[model samples]
Target: MRMAKIGLLLDEQAAVDKWAKQENVFAFYIREVLDHLGIPYQNLSKETASLEEIDLLITGLLNESQQALTQLLSFVEEGGTVIHLSDSPKLANWTGYKSVCGGAGYGYTPKELGHRKPVRFLKTNHWYNGEPAGWNAKSGFLVSGSPAGQILSELWTVIQAGNGKIVHCQADIPYSIVGIQQGVEPILHDGEPAPDGTAGIDDGLLKADDGFTLDWSIDRAATETGMKYFSEAHADKWREVLVHKLAELALEKGLTVPFVGRWPEGIEHIATISHDSDFNLEESADITLSLLKECGVYSTWCMIEPGYERPLYERIKQEGHELAFHYNALEAEGGLWSESEFKRQLQDLKSKADLKTVYTNKNHYTRFEGWGELFEWCEKEGIQVDQSRGPSKKGNIGFLFGTCLPYYPIAWHTENNRQYDILELGFLTQDLDHHALADTSVIDPFLEEVKRIGGVAHFLFHQLHFLEQPKVSEAFRKLVKAARANKFEFWTSKQISIWERARRKVKIEGVSASGEPNVSGAVSGANTVIWVPVPKKADLAAEAAEVRYGHLCLKKILSHKQAQTS
Candidate 1:
């Protein structure tokens, strides 16, 4: 049997960021765990291929790719399985959909939809191995003309295109939709498992003719009640459900899923630290760097040049560290330094030290109104990467809040009515800059939100924050530990080499499709050529010394020549 290929269609940026914030939660952690288990999966985007190559498709309502939906139906036709989950069944308009609302809190509060009730699995004379049913007296009603209604109304659909099966669950209930492809007789009534390994007539388990059974017996009432009364417990259950379901899905699909890997599991974690200046704060930098180095991690330090201690920057570079400009242009009263000045500053820093990369974090939450200028400068100067996209507002001057994940920046030229000169490497994510230390626990929740949306967790930290207090250090250490324990791979800005290589390959392969300018050749030439700075010296030599006898003989010859001339 060939290994199954599972494709998850989600909002990639949102998912990744969400996962990072909630790394302590099981759902966030399981993403890494599943990847460690080697699940073959990829995030579905506009560029993904057809469903013929995929065996399973797991999607949520938030995943709004029409291409994905079309491919999902095709995969099902190819004898594949589709699992759909959402707060409302109204979202999924695909075929073979049956929704059952109202679960006994199920560890989630069912709002405007209805009241909480116990969810049960029922066996029906249909292709589905198990059908989910809920009993909520308040609003346990089913849609009359919806997908669920169609499935419940028709015994089966003529297997056209392919032998595909879809299992749709409404209201986030627990149930498995496997074994429908195999020919089996469906049980007519709902049943429950016996107390001592026996079967009893209850409304939870469903049996089929071929010894295939669907079990929905995970007890969650206690968890639900706990969540209702205690806030933390509820949060815990939410995480637990997400993690357990993801794991179960991985197992059911029989594929190794990665939480953070190349191609699919995108950018994992981003570290933030302060830069040097008159306010250089050496003690803080020392402590933070020491702890990170001890843990074998290299983080990006956003230094404010001129204010930064040049010696410290040199040391950081020597230690194989990365440096990004913490632009305090406003503080420096640089009066919105021109793009040329910015390029000159960056080049000067590179010349002074063996620096390889740069990121920018403006002082006092400063943002450049015209990012095109900054991006153009970066491209022209071969500054391959940047991450100056923050202050936590919904949007930057013109960019989106979460739009910094290593994409090629598009520059439009108005005169020619065309676009040109894209950046090789772009910003990823930025930290929520409004909070202070210890109060930074909000980072976790923010990371969780990023993970859910498939965004990178770029955290910004000040050296001063961690230096004064061990508590901050401890908190950061715990965060790192949790991230690692959950399988998040640590990377510095330099490691973006992996992303660049992959991106270049993709760009080269689909130049036309990307519609970006073809300046690779020019960029490559500039990077390869070397220029020597020092001038060459002219040769000069002194006459060699001679022995006394040799000197006497030379004088005699010179006298004879002078007499002949006279």
Candidate 2:
């Protein structure tokens, strides 16, 4: 394959040049990494480069010029690929180019409002060939319209001019772009392709530049809707594509697909339910559990347990559903408690009941703070997981989909020499908890990130919110179904027990060592304990008989399912 000569246009900002040195900055770093990888390339600022010499043009948000954009579009018309970064979509649209922009959020740092900010990942859409199922953004725009609003209406128009591709991200960079240029693609642990064009392999290594493997299920579903208008149907399809694409990328990369399994991966159906002090979750829990049992799936409930009935927790346990600590008390307290106090409170709450496994801990208003301390506390308390991190203006900033799946906390603290149990399973994307639900397209980039990092996606949901609005429920249903259809295994907190066992087995056998696990070696066919969710009315005796008598497969028991049944 012939290497394409690349051109970059940026403002006089010295930061842009500095950013170019970092391998992860996709737009700026692509030039240097390509050169190092033996791929020919060239870099020129907007002030110096001529349009004719550039095969692919990349520009910062501030350096967008109408004349320059016009010249670049002309170059694309002449069979070139112009890669615009930052807020260039606005300027490109102003120059009469039509572009599809999605995934907008508040800037990470206030200084990057209008400048080039790193986009987290790119959503798979039409126009790009072999485009990684997604891409990471270094400096993206704070879009003016909706979350998936039109930042570059005209950029899309120009994209249609020639057989060129245009990718506009409104989020943060997805993965280490530095790895991509080195021929290491980011993929889910299960060997799916990553958004950033990386592939996870069985050898536990990422193979970069796999030549664009399209996720057929995702692509076909997304293409069903016209890319022009943002319809609910279109949004649904986008979610399906995003989930499947991520899973496919993970499988391609040879990593364990988090949350979902590999074979006939459990039903992808999921529900998100929210509640406050005024309403109780008893009825909601019963109904949801019943529905999930009928579907052969599990329900993961994010509960703001305050002035509600305590029995609700038991009901969740009784129903074999997952219970997540919804930090409404923290939210209602107005961020007043110190880290020590918060940790103590969390510990106290866990002691209240046999509250399944505390797989996820989310804030009521999504206020994630003192995460370093929370993680430490979880470690000290032997809490296995904490799914509280997300893109919050108040919480730590660097955690934007950095650890989307369940992983050993890189930031855990130990009082003694003993290893503390702590895992941070952050959300894939923030749920529209309070306001009217927007298009599911907003989460496309996030789903791509999940695939790229081989992470678990803990989606947030409120029972009242879904019950009041069926659209939200439908959206949730579609996402789960799509994930399952793509071979993603749906898991509740209890199911995390199974994951814990699998993870431990991998760790014990050194399977997840720096290199690959010896699947065909001594560890082949090793029996690990796996958790399965049984219905409230499920015959516990029968279920046990099935497992003991070889009628069912058992992995591990991280939680007290036997006690609950008793």
Candidate 3:
């Protein structure tokens, strides 16, 4: 394999173990974001390692050393790109950013509106896509730095060296990412939440609003959604913007970075539709099947207690669909939100489905009990993916869970900061137009955004909704047609999880002179395609599709068709 031009400051797993031991889960997240971007990178052995062969470096620093600082200054003077993530005065000095008090807030900050100097919780990141993209800081100080450098969104400054540049973020970006992606753990620790809309219950299950509230207070401001109960995940676009910034920087320094395509075979974008059979009825199942069959789409159908009959389950799979478990923990619906109950229900559903493997699950009514516990249970039950984290309310829909990508959930605040084995197949919205609060207004923009970034647009529907709601049925058909016309592929939840996991093992074994990357990895049924960033369009194959994608920095996002298969 070729040596990676970009380097992360520490061993990925070791950083997690090392920084997380101190109980601050936000200290090590540069590597996490890079991995999410699929950018190939090597880990620097030490903070002061040689940078002769490295074009760019990204590091999240809580503290810095004089010697390491001296080395970094020297490296930047010699035209090396650096994206320094920290508010430490030591690191910020050389990076040309001054740290000032940002006004303390937790999970998110207060929004100042109608004031002369409005404090923006989320700011548009001009580096990634000029004026179109935005990300936020969970908690951090203000950006104060050299006036000579171009400041970005009041959070960072961009300083140009002889042949290099540096973007200094005063806000701790990695911490914000962790806080947004995985919500802050409740102080109560699932000690017991009052049942929904009732007084406290001793069920030991977390309430719907347990893990991810903005500020742990009433009437807190959020991403301008005007809801006291809003999600910061939508504002947490740091990971995507940061990685893209790194890619642009690498290209500026004459490096071709190859990241695994988000969708297999270089498909433009992908989507998944899943139905939760809350009532476990056959007519709804038949309706869903007929609807999808008409549109040439395969879907994942999650079954609740006593699942669909064995024949129905078999038929679902036979027709190229997937059968998954829908854990019902709504106490009002005879739900016992216990781990044992989850396992028993999962096992029972599998038996009814006559399945050797059931890899996906989405809780009934999105009833989540605890953070990390559900993921742990899924891991133990051999479930590969869990899709329980998404918006259930109208204002919270679309990018409310932070991302549409399927990623492994990280166990925060623990000694290990362990990355779980199961993939969290998070969705954008549940039904396009079903719930009483179903706002179909967010659908078009969400789908467009997902395609722009090459991500999955998972949509959820209830079996009963399809049968009873005329609007839902109309919305479903229109969604399928629109997605197909827009060149999106509809995959089962199981297939999405499998493909995401498989891509982790892909490697750019070699690169061609035309900036094409040769990949190695056996994709059982799909051909492999790699996306390579190159400066010169003439260098790439004449027929290959290329798009000019960047903010200020421009690079041809050349699609390499060098395919390999088993």
**Top TM-score prediction, candidate number:** 3
Residue-level lDDT of model 1, residues 1-566, one tens digit each, is: 12335665544443444445631111122222223222345566342445666666655423335654565666777777655543223333344433443312222222221212322222221222243342332212222232233223121112233676654443332121111111112234443333433223242322121122222133211122121000011222222233333433334443322221222222334433333332557777677668878877777665655534668777776776677655443423563446756766666666554566554323323334332455566566655555543322211111122222333433322211112232222221222232321133444544453344233445555566566556666666766675566455566655554443332321111112112111221112112111111111211123111111001001011121222232
lDDT of 2 at 51: 62
Q: Model 2, 379: alpha-carbon shift in Å?
A: 1.6
Could you estimate the TM-score for every candidate?
0.41, 0.41, 0.78
- How well is each residue in 1-566 modelled by candidate 3, as lDDT tens digits? 23248766643443555565655545455655666546677778476577888777776543266777777777788888777665456655555545443422222122211111212222122222232124443221242222222333434556677666676654555655555566656324543332232223234554433454333232122333332222223323445446555655666655666666666554778889988887778998888888888888888888899878888887888999888888988888788778899998988887777777889998876667545778888989999988887755554455544567787777755535667888887776666666564455555656776775577888898877888887887888888777887888988889888777766666665566655466665555665556665554333335455542342221223222333341
Predict model 1's lDDT versus the native: 0.37
Model 3 poorest 10 in a row by lDDT: 111-120
Is 1 or 2 the stronger prediction by TM-score? 2
Q: Candidate 1 vs candidate 3: which has greater lDDT?
A: 3
TM-score of 1: 0.41
When sorted by lDDT, best at the front, the candidate numbers are 3, 2, 1
lDDT of 2 by residue, 1-566 (tens): 11223455644443344345532223343332222112223456545367675545555333445565566556666765544445454454554534443432222212212212222223311222222223223322232223343342111212445755443433322212222111122222323433332212223321111211222122212212211111121211222222222222222223221211211123222222222222444555555555566556665565553423567677666776666555443434553335565555555456665553465565444433322455565555555665554423211111233333343432211221112255444443333323433346534543444443333455655555555665665666666665655445566654653444343432111122122222211112223222221222333543331121011222222222321222
Error (Å) of candidate 3 at residue 261 is 1.6
